[model samples]
Target: MKAWQATPPFGFDALRLIDLPRPTPGPRQVLIKVQAAALNYRDLEMATGTYQGQPQQAFTLLSDGAGQVVEVGAAVTRFSPGERVIGCFWQGWEAGRLSDSAALPLGGPLDGMLSEYVLLDERGVVPCPAHLSMEEAATLPCAALTAWQALVVEGQLKAGDWVLLQGTGGVSLFAFQFALLHGARVIVSSSQDDRLKRLAKLGATGLINYRSTAIWHEQVMAITDGYGVDHVLEVGGPRSFTQSLQSLHPSGQVNVIGYLGGHQGEINPLLILQRNARVRGISVGPRQSFESMNHAIEASGLRPMIDSMHDWLKLPGALAHLQSGRHFGKVVLRITAD
Candidate 1:
């Protein structure tokens, strides 16, 4: 089997494609003939030695992948040989709160799906939605599930509620779609006006160009008629956290998902106190929630937005593109199944 691995002094130059013998899965595992994969900001971090998941040894570089179940091990029953599946980000986390960091996520601590073939525990994969292509299904493992967990599973977003989204990254766009899917109004902010305009065409009720509007939360308030948004998908860590808090309604929830902006900034406890906010950190999500989200995607015919695609062998270039911060949505890698 062909695989991609990044070694020490990690970066694009350190990445290499290597060949390894594929093996049979154990009784509780399944073998996947990976067809497509997707890149995330976390994958870029893993390539650059910055992922907080765990210290990297030599490992595969992406967590998001979708493939066909070519062979199931002796005890496997949930999936069959022809079924389409997407690998879970956290292998052992099936549902609920994560009390320990023992189940280290993929793309860093564990060998991920950036191989021609990969093995996963039977419980660590979800069935792909029938309507989505392999490239689209590959995107659901991390970003889409994080958005679903934030807005639907935990936040309990409802119709007429307002959601404040950050830039047009994978998670933010999925949040935008999910917010509208639940009948909620979306107010998204980005430094790029073109992406904001695109989101407006896709049903975003409000758009703010944060680059022009220095204080964007004030714009959020104005858009919502001073009521503030009911939810904020807080991606910009410390630098944008203050405004995200300010953009929320008094009882609004903030799902802390990423630290896209510079990580260093002072956070006032009063932001939480004064707003009576529920600030929660989202760790992608569990396989059970992933399954529920797939059902919704199937029902609504929600296709994932893709910014660009590259051949799987062009992973270095793909990672560079992600690092450049030029993409508007998920970047896909089409794996040629030989």
Candidate 2:
């Protein structure tokens, strides 16, 4: 088998696709023939030496992948050969609140799925929605699940509520789709006018190009009839946190999943108190939530938006593309020929 590993002195140039021995699964594990994987902004961070807590050892480098089970262990009853599945981001978190201690997340602290074949405990994977392909399924484990956790699970989003999205990244796009799924209205912001137009076509209720209007939160309030959005997918970290609070509908939830805006800026607690804000930092999600979201996806027939697809072997260039901030949706890697 072959795996992409980021050895010490980590950077894109340090990535090496190396050969490794394939191992049989343990008694409760399953072996999957990985078909596709998706690159997150975090993956780009890992490549550019910008991500925090960089791994010290070489490990398979992706937290999101989808494939078919080719073999199973003696006691692995949850899955069997030929069943399509996606790995969970938090392998040990099945449901409920997270404890102080949990299993290492994939791609950094643990071996990820950017390999020809990967082994996982039966509990660490979920069935791919029947309506999605391997590439689409690969985009879900992190970005999609994170949006579901923040919007539906935590915010308790309902019809007619308003949502504020930060950008055209995978998570924002998924949140857009899910908000539409629940009959909610969405207001999205971006620096690119062309991308905002594209989002408009995808049913964005209000659009703001932050480049033109720095005070975008006022637009959010104005769009919602001087009230504000019910939820804000705060992807801008500290730089946008203050505005996210301002754009809330008194007691609105702000799900902070920021990484793009480099973590430095002043956030006043007075804004939180004024808005009665409910801010929660999202950590992707657990396996049970993944399963529930899969059911909704399968039933709603919601397809993930892919900005581009690359061959798995061409990961360096793919990561570079993602780093360039040009992609409007998920950038997927086809690991094997379909």
Candidate 2: residue 195 lDDT (0-100) = 93
How much is the lDDT of residue 43 in candidate 1?
Answer: 87
Put down candidate 2 lDDT per residue, 33-137, tens digits, no spaces: 999999998887766666788877777899999999999999998999999999988878888876743767888768888999989999999999998999999
The TM-score that candidate 2 achieves is: 0.98
lDDT of 1 at 236: 87
Computed on alpha carbons, the lDDT of every model, listed in order, comes to 0.90, 0.90
lDDT of 1: 0.90
RMSD of 2: 1.3
lDDT of 1 at 11: 75
List TM-score per model, in order. Answer: 0.98, 0.98
lDDT by residue (135-235, candidate 1, tens digit) is 99999999999999999999999999999999889999999989999999999889999988899999999999988998998999999999999999999
Which residues of candidate 2, in runs, are more than 4 Å off? none
